[model samples]
Target chain A: MKQYKHHTLSVLVENKAGVLSRIAGLFARRGFNIYSLAVAPTDDQKFSQITIVVDVQSAPLEQITKQLFKLINVVKISELDPATSCEYELILAKINAPGNNRASIIELVQLFGGKIVDIGISQLTVMLADSPTKVDDFEALLEPYGIIEVQRTGRVALAKQETSSAKLRSISGKVS
Target chain B: MELTGAQALIKSLEAQGVEVIFGIPGGAILPVYDPLIDSPLRHILVRHEQGAGHMAEGYAHVSGRPGVAMVTSGPAATNIVTALADAYMDSIPMVCITGQVALGSIGTDAFQEADTTGITMSVTKHNWLVTSAQDIPRIIKEAFHVATTGRPGPVLVDIPKDVSNQLMQWYWPDEVDMPGYKPTVKGHPKMIKQAAKLILEAKKPVIYAGGGIIRAGASDQLKTLAELISSPVATTLMGRGCFPDEHELAMGMPGMHGTYTAVTAIQKADLLIALGVRFDDRVTGKISSFAPNAKVIHVDIDPAELGKVRHPEVPIVGDVGYVLTELIKEIKNLEKKQDQSDKSAWLKQIKDWQIRFPLTYDKEQTKVIKPQFVVETLSANTPEDTIVVSGVGQHQMFATQYWKFNRPNQWVNSGGLGTMGFAIPAAIGAKVANPSAMVWAIDGDGCFQMTAQELVTASSEKIPIKVAILNNAYLGMVRQWQEMFYEERYSEVYLSPDLPDYVKWAEAMGCVGFRVESPDEVAIVIEKANAINDRPVVIDFRTDSSEKVYPMVPSGASNDDIVVDPSQGQGGM
Candidate 1:
C-alpha cells in the first residue's frame, strides 16, 4: 500500500488547561503523525476545535476520535473532507521601500487592498488578507520593490456551516 | 508596541523556547547582533556560517527541537545553503536568519548584498524577506511555526540591514493566521484498510523505517507494530537506533553499504512495507532490480514522496507512525500466520553467504592496517546509545557495517545527498544536544580534510565528541573503482602528504588526540576517548588504503548479484 497523504481532521477538545498539549501528546505517542494542526475556540458552548492534516491511509478515524475523547477535556472529534468543505488561509508581508520608491510601493499596496500598518524612514509595513495563494501572489508583486522581511501563518480552517464537524465519517466498509 | 524589530525577533524566539543560537557576526547583521548580545539567548560564534547551520541541524536532530542559525548577508548567507539543503532533505527542523543589505542599496549591486531569498527558496520549505519592522514579531513567530510543523524542513528569513536597524513597536500575538500552508494529519480509512489487507495476504513481509519515525516521535508505535506483526524491520542509516538493534525482527540498515543479511532479506521479501522512508538510492539500489518480487507498500507524511521513486502497490500518504498503528490494529484482528514456519531456506542462504564472507579483519596480521578492525573496535567500545555520525566513503561504510546501533536517532550521516565534511560539525551538534550520549564522528582521510576546520568549533563548544579518523592513506572507495574498472591505473587518487597526526591536530585545537597504529591499541585508545567527557578528542587510526567494503551490489545491480567477498576472488568484469 502506498502511503496516504492529505487527511482532514476535526478534534473536539477540552476548552481548559493543557488540552492542546494533551491532544498533541496523543498524536505524538500514537504515532498518528499529523502534518498540519490548527486549534482554536469554537463558536459553540465552551468547546475547542482542532483541525489536523494527517498523512494516513484508509483507517479508522473513530478510534482516533474515541481516543481523543478519552482525554477529560476532549469532548468530541471528527475528520473532515476538504473536498466537501471550504478551506481558507490568511497571510501578511512587510515591504521595504527605498527612499525614492514610496509612491510606487503605495500604489502597489492599494492594488491588493492591503493597508500600511507601519511606516518608517526606510521601511513600509504592508498587510494583506486573502487565501495563501493570494498572499504568495502579493508577495511576488512586492519582490521587485525589495522585501525586507516576511512572516506567514500556515492554513487554518473550520467545518462547513450547519453541519456538525464533530461527527465521524464512515469509512469504505472494508474494516468490517 | 515598544519593542524594536530585532528585539521582537528575540521575543518571538524566546516564545518558541529557543535557548541557543549559532552564528557568525558580520557588518550587515550588526543591528540584529547588537540586540542578540544583550538578549538571554546564548549565541555560539562559529568560524564559518556553514558550520553554524549544520550545528543547528545537529542540535535539532538530537534534541527534536527546531535549531536556529543566524548570519549576515552575501557570502555568509550563501555558506549556510549546504546545511539548509541537508536539513531540508533529512526533514530536520531549522530556522536560518540572514541580514541583507539596506533597502536602498538592495538590487543596486550593494556591497555585501545577495539575493538570499531567491537563492534559498528552492532549498527551504518557505522563506520570508521582511520589509517593515512592524511585521517582525509576527513573521518570526510564523517562521518557527512553518519550520516545525508538518513534514519539518528548514525555513529562511532575510532581514534587510535597514529593517533590522528600524525602530518600530512589536506586538506578540497570542495567535496568527495563515491560509496557504495546511499540512494533513489524519489517515484515510480506505488506504489504511488496503495496507492492512496487503499485510494479511503477504507471506513474507518487512517494514522499513526512516528518519520520520524519530521526527514524529513514534519510535514506540513502530516497535509495537513490528512486534504485533511478527515481521522483520530494517532501517535506513538515518533510521538506525530508532528501532532497538537487538529486536528479533530488527535487520539493521540495507543498501550499498548495508548489512549483508538485511539486504538479502529485503531482496527475498514478497511484501515490503516502508514507513516514513523516501526510496533513497542508497536504500534502493537500481530501482528496477530492487525487490522485483515484493509488493511495495509505502507510507510517508509528504505526498511528494509517495510514488517519486518505485511505484507502490499501495501508497498510503500519511504519517509513518499513524499508518503503522492502523495496520497493526487490522493485522491483530485476523492474526493470520502465513509463514510461521521459519524460512530456513532463506535464513540458511543468508547464513552461507555470511560464512563465505564473514565481516572480518586479520588480528595477527603484520603489515597493513585494516579499516574493518578500527570500525569493529570502535563499535565494541562505543555504547549502543552513542550516536555515530559518518562522512561518505570507505570509513562511512565501515562504520555502518561495524557499529551496532540499537537506539533510534543515534546514527546521523548525509545519505540522500552524500555530502562530505558532514560528520565533524554534526557530531558537535549531537554532542550539544545529548550531553550524556557518546558521539563518535567517523571520518575518512579525504572527507575529514574537507571540513577539518570545524574542529575549532567542536573545541570551542566543549562538546567533547570523539572523532575517529579512519586514516587509510588513499581514497579507498575511489581506488577500488579504479582497480575494478580502470585496471588499477591509480589516477589522481593519491594524497602523498603525510597524514597530519590528527592526535596533535586535536591538541592544536586545545583538545586531546590519540593515534592507534596497531589493532590491539584500537580498543584501549577508543575506550580512553570514551572515558573523557569534558572536551572533544580525535583518534587517527592508521588503516590500510586498499581495503574495500564487500557484499557489493554495484550501483544498478540486483541483490542476487551481490559480491560477498571481493578481496578473495580475482578481479573480473
Candidate 2:
C-alpha cells in the first residue's frame, strides 16, 4: 500500500443538489482526510465529475473508493494512477516586480509556461495551470520577487489517453 | 390523477407497501397530515421524534422491511437524528420523511425552517430535498429503495411545505434505476470455493457472526454451514439471536461483555469465518492483537466492510445469505463429509472453559431481587417466541445474557450506538410488527427514565408491550467503570429511585404499574405482567446497583486478558 501513493480519485456523480455535500459528509463522518477536491458539471448536464485527492496517510484508498461507491449519486469511481494520469493545479500569484527585477520574473514565468494576467507598476499578477509539481517549482522560482498574495485551486485530474491500457483495479485489497 | 404532493407522498407510501408509520406531525408537515387522515397508512403518533425513529427501527429489525418514520422540519428532524444514526450504525432499513419550510423560505430561516437534508447528510445513507412537486413520486421511490437495499440504512426525504400542497400529476415510477447502487448479492464462485477450502481444512475455526445474518435472513444457511463444518459460532452483541444459544456449536456472544468461552475461542482459533461483522473495537479489544493466529474469511453486503478492520484472506463482498448458501454448496462439492472427531480437541478445550467460567450470580443469598434473576424468570415465564427488547446498560447485557434465543430477530437492542432509551419504543414497534407475539422491554432505571413517556403512546394505542424496569437507581455501567478505572469516585451516577415514583408515573400514563423488592416477588410479578393483554404494563423491580457485568475485556486490552467474575477466583480469571 505504501507504493501506491497517488490518492486522486475521478468520481462521476449525478448533478443533483446536495451531491457534493453527501460526498464531503461521508469523508467527515468516516474521518477520511480529503486534501483536495474539485467539482464541475460534465457535458451531459445531468452528471458531474468530482476529482478528489485524499490524504493517504489518514485513510486507505480502497475504503475511500468503496465508501464513495455507496453514494447513490456516484456513477463511477476511477483511482487515477500518477504515472498514467494527467493532473494539474492552477495558481494565481501577485508577485512584486519592480523595473529592476521585472525582466527576470517575466523570463522565469515564461520558462514555467505561466502568463502575467495583470501588470501594475510594482507587481505582476501571474497565473499558471500545470501539474502540481510544476506549479510548486514556479511558485518557488518567483519567491525572491516577494509574492504579495497567492491563490491555488484544488487539483483536477483525468487518466492519460492511449497509455497502453493498464488495469485500473488496485491490487492492494482482495476485491473478489 | 392530479393530486397535491402531500397526497402523492401518502399514496406512494401505500404503493410501497408501508402499512404503518411512526411519527409526529407539526407546522411544516400539517398539509401532509391532512391527506394522511384518509390514507390507508396507520400512523402511530409518538411522544418524541426519536421514539418514532426507533420504533421504525424496531419494526424493521423484526420484519426485515424498511421502517418508515416522518417528522416535521427544524427541531423535529433534529430530534430523530439519534435514531437515524442508530439505524445507520446497525444497518436497519428505515425511511424517514421530513417536512421542510416553503421553498422560498428554505434558506431565509423561516419559522421551523432547517437545512434538514444538509444536517442529516452524514447520519443518513442517502437523502433528498424535493425541489419540485413533480419529483415526489420518483424521489419517494428512490428513498425506500436506497433505505431497504444493499446494506440497508436510514434514508431521509425532505419535502418543503409548499411542495406538499402544490398540485401535480400523480405517477409512480415503474422501476428503480440507480445504476451506481447495484449491491452484489452473490459471492464470487472462486472466493466461495476458497472459503470452503479454508473452513474444511482448519482444525479450529470460529464463525464470528453479526447482525447481517438476521438482516439477510441467512440463519438457516448459517446453521447449515456451522453444522456441516462443525465450527463454533460466536454471535456479536448485534448478532445476538442469529445463532441459537442452545445449539452445540454456539459460542454465545463475543465482545467486551462476551462469555469466557466465546472470547477465548476466537483468540485460539486458526481460521475466523466472520460473516456480516465489522471487527468493532468492543468486539476486538486491541485490533493489533485480535485473532492473531486466525486467517479471516469475511462476508458482507457492504464491500467497504471487507478489509476495513481485520483484513480477510478471502473477502467475499455479497449478501451473507447468498455467500453462506454458496459456501455450503462449495463445501459439499469439495468434501465428502465432516467427522465430528476432527474438531473434538477444540470442542473439549471450549467445554473446559465454559464449565470453569459459566455465567453465574449469587441469587441464593441476596435479599433483594437480582437483575439477572429477573431476566431469567422473565425469559422462563414469557412465550418462546417473545421478542425481548433492551436498552443500553448493564440490564441490556443481562437481558441478552440470560435469554435463550433459538431463532433470529427474537432479541432487539441498540448495539452500535448504544442508545439508552431504545427498548420501550422499539418494543412497541416490535409488537406492532407481530401483534400476536409477546413483546417485553427490559430496561435499566437510567434507561427507562429516558423514554418512559412513550408508555403513554403505547397505552393510548393499546400496544400492550410489557416493560420491566430494573431499578438499581444508579447508572450501573458508568458506576462499574468509575469503580474499576476511576477509583470508586462516583460522579453523578446515582438517581434517586423513589423521587420519580415510577409506579405512579406509570399510572399517570394510563398503564398498570407495580413495584417489587423481595426475590420471592420476582416470579409472581413476572407472571402478572405476562397476563396483561388490554394495555401496556410496567414492573419496577428494585435491583442491587452494585452488581456488574462480568467477563469484561477492560477496554482495549486483549481478549486473552478477560476479567471473569470476581467470585470465580484466579484473580477474576
Candidate 3:
C-alpha cells in the first residue's frame, strides 16, 4: 500500500487573468488532489502568492513539483516543511448558546485564545486564528454546544526567520 | 510612429522575421487584411482555417521557426482548435492570431463573436485577448517568445475589431520581462558526468532519441554521442529523421509497427539513454514491462516529462542540443574507454534480429498494388533532399516504416495527435518554406478527402507540392483493427473508389491528376507527377484495400507479446 502525506507548497506566480485557472487545470488534469488553497496578492503587485495543501503519495510528490514548474505563469515554488514553518488557520463557528452551555463555551473559547465576534439572542459567533491543531481542538470543544455553522480559511504558512548570528556566519563563510 | 493596431501587429510580425503567414480573411479581421495588402510578408489564403493552422505547423516543423497563422473570430477560431491541439500534443512552436468581436459587444452575442481565449485555454501554451491597441506590439512579441521557448507549443492572441482599428504609438519592446518564463538551457555538469559514467559502464546500451532532437537541432550531437560510445540508436516515430536511417548503428523506429530489431534492442538493453522523449504510451507498451531491465537516463527540456510516466535514474532538464553537447564533453573528460569486445555480442544479437525479421510485405502475391510497395517505390524515386509528409493511419505507418529518412526534419507527420487531414496543407507549407526542395504528402484515401480542399490553395499560391494518395478505398487502420479484434465484423469503413474520382477532383481543383491501378504504371505516374513543377500534382494509386500494417502490438499489450505477422499466428515467435 502507498503511504499518503500532506504537503504545503508556496507558489509565486504572475498576477494575470486566468493564471489561477491554468494552475488549477494542470492539477486537475494531472490527477493531483488539493486539500486546501489560499491565493492573495504579494507585496509586489506584479506577482501573487498561492499556498496550497495537497495530500499525495510520496512517490509522486517530485513529479507534482516538476509539473508545477512547467506552468509559465508560476514564478517560483517552495515546499514548506511543517516542522520548521509557522502555520495557521482561521475558523468562524456559530454556536447555539442558549443558557447553561454559554458559559462553558466562553471558557473553552478563552482557553483556545478565541474571541466572540458576534452575539445574538440565542447564538454566538466565535472566531479563532491559530495553528491548524488548535483550531481543530477548538472545533471539537464547541461541538457539544450545538455548533450551527463552521467556515475555515485553509492553512497558510511561512518559514521561521533565521538568527542574525547564523545569517552573518553563513555570509562570512561564503566570502571565505 | 503613430499607427493603427493592425498596422502595428503586421510590423511586429515583420520585425520578428516572419516571412509568410497562412490564413483566410473574414469580416472581423478585415482591418488586419487591409494592412497585409501592402506588407512584404507573403500570405497563403487557405480554404479552411484548420488548413491554415496545419500549414503553419508544417512550416515550423521543418524550418525550426515559430509558424504564424491568422483567422477571424467565432467559427474561424473554433475551426482551428484541432490544429492547435495537434501542435500542443506535438510541442510544435506556433502563433495563431485570431480576430475577436468588438470589445463593446464581446459577451452580447455579437455577430462573429466567440470566447476565443476561453475555448483555446487548455489547448494553447498561453493565450491573450488584447483590449487596447498599445498592447499589440508587446503581446505579439510575448506570444512568439512563449510559443518558441521551453518545450515549445502553440500560443494564441485574440484582438478585437475595435482594438485592431484603434491608433497607438508603435514601439517594439527591447526585452520580454516574464519572471516566470525562464527555461533552463544547460544541463547540470554533475548529472551529465553521472550519465556518462553510466553509459561507459553498461555492456548493452541503446540511445532512444525522440522529437526533441529535431526541435533542438541536436541530431549531430546525438550522432556524435552514439558514435563516441559505440552504442546503437533507435528513434521514436517523432524522431524518425533525427538520425540518418542509413547509419550502421541505426535501429529504425521502436514501438508498435516499428522495425523488429529496434523494438527488440530496446527491450533487451541494460541501459536506455532517452533523449527528449516523453516515453509516450504508444512507444512504451504496458509501461510496467517496458525496458524492465534498463536503468534510464532521461533528458528533456520539459521538467514535467522526466517522471510523468516512467521514472529515470538520471533526470536532466535542459535543451537536447545543449545537454548532448555537454554529455559528449563529459564522456571525453572522464577518459573512460568503452570495451568494444563487451558490446560486440549485443551488436551481433541486434544484427541477427534485423536479418531474421526485416520489414517485409508480400508484393508479388497479388496483382493489386500494395501500399507498402507504393511507399517504397515513391521513396526510391524521390530526390535525396525530399521532405515526406503524411496524415494519420496505415499510410502513415507504412511511410514511417519504409521511407529512408537520411536527414533531420525530412519526415514530417502528426505523430502525437494522429490527426488526419494534416497532409495536404502541411505539404504545401513545407514546399512554401523550402521552395527548391521536393515535398510529398503521402496520404490514405480516407484521409485525403478530409482536407483535400487545400490543394486548391496550393495551386493558387503556386506551391507545387506532390500528393501520393494510397487509394485503399477504406479506413485501413481501423478496418484492420476490426478485422483482427472485432471478429472481422467490418463496420462503416469502406469507401467506394468510383464514388468521387480522385483524379477528377484534383483536376477540378486546378491540379494535374493521374491514376495508377497496376504496379507497371506506378513509376510512370510518379515520374510524370514529379515532372509537373508549375502546378500541384496528385497521383491516385489504387492499392490493395486488404493490406494491413504488420509488426502489431495490440494496445496495452507488452512488447514481448508483439506479433510479427498475424497471418502466421497470434502467438509470438
Pick the TM-score winner: 2
Q: DockQ of candidate 1?
A: 0.02
Q: What is the DockQ of each candidate?
A: 0.02, 0.74, 0.41
Tens-place lDDT digits, model 1, residues B1-573? 676677777877887799899898898888888777777998878878878888898888888889899999999999999999888888889999999999889899888889897777657776788988888878888888888877898999899988886888766777756543456566676778777777776667778888888888888988988776667788887787778877767776788767666787788888898888888887788888788789998887776566667878887766776776777777676555442334445445555644555555555675666888877777877776788889888888888777777766778887666778888877888887888888889998788887777788777767788888888777778888888768999898985426676777779887788888877788888888888887888888888877777757777776666666645462112
TM-score (chain A only) for the predictions, listed in order = 0.64, 0.89, 0.88
True contacts kept of 3: 0.54
Q: Is the docking of candidate 1 incorrect, acceptable, medium or high quality?
A: incorrect
True contacts kept of each: 0.00, 0.76, 0.54
Q: Which candidate is the best by DockQ?
A: 2
lDDT minimum window of 10 residues, candidate 2 chain B: B333-342
Poorest stretch of ten by lDDT in candidate 1 chain B: B564-573
Model 2 steric clash pairs:
none
RMSD in angstroms, candidate 2? 2.0
Q: Write the per-residue lDDT of candidate 2 for residues B361-462, one digit (tens) a residue.
A: 886856978889999999988898999999999999999888898889999999999999999999999999999999999999999989888999999998
Sorting all predicted structures by DockQ, with the top scorer first, yields 2, 3, 1
Q: Candidate 3 residues B85-159, lDDT tens each? A: 999999999999999999999899999899998889889988999989999999999999999998999999999
